[model samples]
Target: MTARKRLFFMQLAGLILAFLVLEWLAGVFTARASLPYALSLLAYILPTLPLFGIIPLSLNYTNNNPDLPLSAHRMAPVRRYMVRMGVSMFFYVIILMASIVALDRFELSVQIKALLAVLTALPIGGIIWAVSRLIADPDVDEFERMIMTRSVMASAALTFFFAAIWGFLENFAEAPDFPLYLVVVVYFGLFGLVQPFVRRGFR
Candidate 1:
């Protein structure tokens, strides 16, 4: 594999590992003492940043899309990847701050806070959709887009799966805590984290 592809794989693997480590650490720290409001927000925001890098790379653009100047053309691939990711980070942070404010300046209940973080994807995903289209190869971008779309749909379908199973166990068998937080884990946690590796295999 070329350097870019190798780096892509490394970044992706690192992202998955980071999510597992961070989620575990968050649990341990929250158990001992709750994370500060800002830190808590950061925890939810940080894990998804790696994916900003993945979106442009995953498009697998064989040639530069926008086409930089002749001097910059040689490094066009790296430059394009950086530009795409930079734009994504900008939007991600925007959504993060917006949701933080939307959650009543962090005054909301824990469940609502979690819900805001999970739902931020709705807008952020739109940014991803737009960015991916711009960066994708016209011929093959559709396939990549299809893969991404299916992954999202599958994750969403699993949400219903969890609802049915968890609801039955909770209502019929008397489970505690209601297990609603599992929604985030099932949708974004497992499928969200797992889909990149699956996408990587496509290249």
Candidate 2:
């Protein structure tokens, strides 16, 4: 195998090994064991560190460089991403507030509550799509696109794989049933982690 392909599979194997270790730890320890819980949480966060590098200018956005001009502060691309983030945040806050009010103020059925959450999630999806469109390369070559597609597929597979694994453990193994939202947070982070690996060794 090519170096890139080897690296990719190595990373994948490492992830699976870590999961297996965590599973064993969970199985060995009681539900209240904080050490296993903390280690499991660390495993999730560690894999996603590269995501901090892949997002739109998250790194240097906070750094202060003497050589950089003040004009960098007003760059259009930077402003655009910031605006995208702000708009999405505002809309999401509105949706969350409405959900809270509904749940706290009314005796809503499970179906209605789920429907409301789904409805709110649709706008968030649109916001993500719009932001991606704004920042994506307009003239990406075909090979690069294929690489990106692979990255996306890998990410989705990992997400579903772990989610199902965790779900099974929760139901049959007497492990914890973490909230759906928290699980999605980890999935999203994993999805973003795929971007840096795109187009690597595909040549």
Candidate 3:
């Protein structure tokens, strides 16, 4: 196999492994311990991660390769994959919201939570698609790639720094109320902020 193909296969395998690990962890901790539910959720959710791979693959295949036309049959899988992901995310959201409601209610049934979770995931599907589109643009140029790489590295560094700080604060401070998610959101915003610098650096 070509290097590209090998990379794709490795990525695919890594995603599958990650999905399995998530499912196993969820099963062990959460009341939603059903294997089928875990597997289904993973199938629907994990595709979002590798949507990045699709952009590069599509660009590589289509650019300067008139003879190798975009195969509809091959592309069909990606569409189906996205659809599954959307459905899964939508239901997952519903489940979370419903669980919140269920906790308030008199009964606490696993089945009820599971059903509500699936129902909640519908709207989340739209958000997932939006996120996928935002990140995976087919027209990504060399400059964009550099920006994205640098942004990701910066984000990673920021995350590590924040994690260490949070750990220290927990140990030293009386009430450490660090908003980790907000820090992550800021890091995500930094991607856009650093884009100009990245472009200038390349120039």
Candidate 4:
């Protein structure tokens, strides 16, 4: 495998390891009655930031596979997408951390708390903007666009299916309620998971 391919695989492994470690820490923090709010929030929030990196990485690897000869022209859209996502995710992490800290540290009014919540959700708009930009970008290869569309559809389907199952379980069996926000995470995960299968069909 080429260097990019090797780096991609290494990153993938590192991401999974980080996730497991973070999950364990979160569990430990949850079990402790005296854990700091900051630490507990970090345990929950930090795991999500790394996941955004995987999308652009996968896109780059797929378009510029070592075995495939890709031109600079072909690589531009991927590069652009990476930059957009990187910037968006960066702002998301910063804003989320600030919002969490502010909410925890200060005794704020209900209105302020609601405003903070709105501010925290604002960065998610960046994600939506990035995706919409990618779709509207004329520079992206037709093949890449098709792959992205299919992957998104598959991810959406899986997320909806999982949500339905969890909703029913919560209603009937007294299962733990699933956080609605985690649907985004589940969609992203399924996005990555379905890539290989989607590519196989085109191959």
lDDT of each: 0.61, 0.57, 0.55, 0.78
| Tens digits of per-residue lDDT for model 1, 1-203 | 66766676787778768766865675566457665667765665665555565555555443333331223444444455456556756676657655854574447888987787776665556545544554353433355557666677767787788788878888889877455544654676655665776678788
Give per-residue CA lDDT, model 4, range 39-115, as digits (tens).
Answer: 76666677666666677667767776866566788677667777788778778776776677667667999999888
Instruction: Score residue 194 of candidate 2 by CA lDDT.
Output: 80
Q: What is the TM-score of each candidate against the true structure?
A: 0.40, 0.48, 0.38, 0.74
Measured on C-alpha atoms, candidate 2 has an lDDT of 0.57
> Could you tell which candidate, 2 or 4, scores higher by TM-score?
4
- Stretches of candidate 1 above 4 Å error? 1-7, 13-89, 95-153, 174-185, 188-203
Q: How many residue pairs in model 4 have overlapping backbones? A: 0
- TM-score between candidate 3 and the true structure: 0.38
Look at candidate 3 and give me any clashing residue pairs: 90-121, 90-122, 91-118, 91-121, 94-120, 94-121, 95-117
- Colliding pairs, model 4: none
Clashing residue pairs, backbone N/CA/C < 3 A, model 2: none
Q: Residue by residue across 61-177, what tens digits does model 3's lDDT show?
A: 444245444466544444544555555555554455345534644475788666665555555555445444534645444344456677667666776786787778887885567
Residue 104 lDDT, candidate 4, scale 0-100: 63
Best by TM-score: 4
Ranking by lDDT: 4, 1, 2, 3
